[model samples]
Target: MARDINTKKLKKNAFRYSKVRGETASRIRIPGGVINAKSMAKIAEVAETYGNGTIFVTNRQGVELPGIALEDMPAVNKAIQSIIDDSGVNQEERDKGYPASGTRNVVACPGSRLCPFGCYDTTEFARKMDKMIFPNNLHVKIAFTGCSNDCGKVRMDDFGIIGMTEPQYDPNRCVGCEQCIKYCNIRSVGALSLVNGKVVRDTDLCIGCGVCVAYCPTRAWTRSKEHYFRLVLLGRTGKKNPRLAEDFIKWADEQSIMDIVKNAYAYVEEYIDPNAYEGKEHIGYIVDRTGFDEFFKWIMKDVKLNDKAEVAHRIYWGGKHYDRSNNLK
Candidate 1:
């Protein structure tokens, strides 16, 4: 029997109202895109028991169990408690499901745990960030990629955190083979040149991608011990404008990046449109409305950046605006 449902409440509770009447999908949050095998089995159990025995993987590293009866939401919630607990997702109560579904699951690529080119532990950082800001209703997207290779496609999100590492060059170890130079030109920005039987890295031109370090034959170039990041901001996809995030800070420390993102929530609360659809609005749209200068002031409040961090005074983004004209120029 179909019953009157509060669709708004349903969505906030992390259940997706389906096209089919009296059916909903349970959205499960998977921070860092890494879940244990036991949790995965539990999700499968939930699907088989409550859903149509099918699981839909979401792009944001979440899972959705579709074809669940609307009335079975409570049972579904209780069944998924173990998965929620295992994932370390913050909750207001046990067996009540996700408290809020605004902030999307933190997405990450396999970093130092698996990939050779990875500069840092992307999954660890993603999980930490998720812990700081979850169980809230904020239309924000954040992603972490292992390195500039950007396997995570982070540039499409609101906060794209790309890994970086400053290369430490040792002239003593360099054999003048120029392998670093060759590969840097091919795989990354050509910031290295041979000088006096050794390689000279153009510090001004280097984006800290550490390509030279990876190709160094005799450990002539090595990554810095201090892990750094390239923080790109405000990229989004929508009907009006779909754009990639621009560089906000380079060579940024992890703590400063986390603090900056945390501050952004306050900025959004102060400036988000009251009439935004379902009280949800992308941070990029809010930035567009308030202007970058204002957004910067708000986002940078009390956030202390390290000395090596380079911040962009201003950012500009260009993308296809579907809301505009159809006439090709």
Candidate 2:
């Protein structure tokens, strides 16, 4: 008789159960969606050898080899071993499948390496975040967008990390061209305006998108060394309320970003429902059960933010409970 599939182990390797009994689909991790040609060949080989000779690219930018029989899992897993190493799927520990399954694939937009508008190295930073938080059972989605274009759809993810740049202006070099103002009005947070024939940036309205900084001529605008990040949180799709992720962190440094994300895992562990199905609960749902005030308390617990970093001044969700009371949940 074929051995029973170890649901726990398979999930750790990014496998999902199929409709057909005694079969599964293995999700191959490609952090930041960056994959080498050689690795792609190996994945195809695994599919042909142990699966249905096919692989599906997940919306999260990973690969899923379908039609794996429970009996063939061992062979499939062995094939995946080298890939896990080369891809750094779960390098948090050695000789282990994965610690948890909550943190999903780290999706990213094309970075400065490929796009001129890109601000940071999306794939590199995404890899760093992948190793930092993975294999956890809590349901979470983390994504990285290179710039304000948000080609990666950061706003729709559980944790959206958007690259930011603080533009420093040299008034002496100002040509009174009103170019920044024109650029800022569209495709931006509407923070720039002409003041006395020079561009004045409204700090409150600015989202740190670097639009003016990019379009500014004569080198009047320069990027800050701080390398800030804007973090949006909690947006999800589920049986109940589906809403866009809300912005929480603005102008955060790498350290602050890492710390807040690390702390968020702790928050999930603390408030996570015990009776959740499949040994998991969406963090968004947990936030619903508990109040946002309570949820953020845990998120912000014991974390020191940078002076530049701004926490959500007042987080307000207009949507009501499923009951339709229309109050913040």
Candidate 3:
């Protein structure tokens, strides 16, 4: 799990004019991966005025401006700092890492904040994640998405938050159309004709993909207000290496979400070897080598578990299945 100096090289080469090989390379963190036209313009100005006229975007949604001279690093930092200050973020707050630190590392899609199909406000929750649990000892990337659509590509991160909603059955509105059953790819739904010439739905099989709800003409499959989010950890996606994160927790609220993140960081800090590999930075590699169950127990030493149902759930991805029962129980 050597750190991909080559990946960094590719990134650097992509913005060749940025001169990343020098001693004073600059890295800029963008909170929630959010950027405004004005902020971008300021970045361009900084590139032109302070350093080379180029920028590189990181997978974590950070921007790096290379080729900055050692002497000019202070100026570049100041210029970027000023723009961040005028961007409605307080200077003092920035110093205190309000929009930096863990917040800066967060990448979130425009969930319910603006997207019509979004089931939740992923941006808002991402901001909360930055503030509450980001400053810990964890060194892996975390990503969030507003819905199962995963526009933010949460599956690629060490920790991922996916928005989800459970469908509610309206017995009165159900026309037994079986449209939902037809559209469901997961076969989580089933329909049967009733004596009254209407269809009845079996809710147990519904996987909550929303396919039925979208196609249903009768609007029988409506989303409930009881919507929460999904949490996954130790997942990675790429061509050379592909893996799916196991579900650490599901349908979690803000408080539970914080607890999960804290637990994850605690685990990483306790057992992971920092010098294991130069570029072996993510959590999945650690799990691959040390075993996830042992990792989980090391972190949950003081915590008590009441339920282990989710532990037995198998995670299927990358054409392989991983049973987490040993880790959970």
Query: Which candidate's TM-score is highest?
Result: 1
lDDT for residue 151 in candidate 3, whole number 0-100: 79
TM-score of each: 0.98, 0.90, 0.71
- Which candidate model has the greater TM-score, 2 or 3? 2
Candidate 1, 174-275: lDDT as tens digits = 899999999989998899899889899888888888788887879989999999999999898988899999999999999999999999998998999989
Residue-level lDDT of model 3, residues 1-329, one tens digit each, is 33224333332222222334443445555546677778788888887786668877777777776666545544665677655654333333343222223223678888777875566777667766766554343456778887777778887777788776667667788877766666564443343235464545454443344556667788777776765667777677543355766676665555556666667676666667768553344666566677767766654455443331133233433523344233545
lDDT of 2 at 185: 86
Model 2 clash pairs are: 100-135, 100-136, 101-135, 101-136, 102-136
RMSD of each: 1.1, 3.2, 7.9
Question: Which runs of model 1 end up more than 4 angstroms from their true locations?
Answer: none
How far off is residue 136 in model 3, in Å? 5.4
Model 1 scores a C-alpha lDDT of 0.92
> Candidate 2 on 1-329: residue-level lDDT in tens?
74666777777656686888878887787888887788888899999988899889888998888898877766776777777888777655554434555678889998766976677889988999988887666778899988777899987788888888888999988898878888888778789877887888898888777778788888787777777788888777665676778888888777777777888888888888878787677677787788888877777777788887788855654433454555665
Best by lDDT: 1
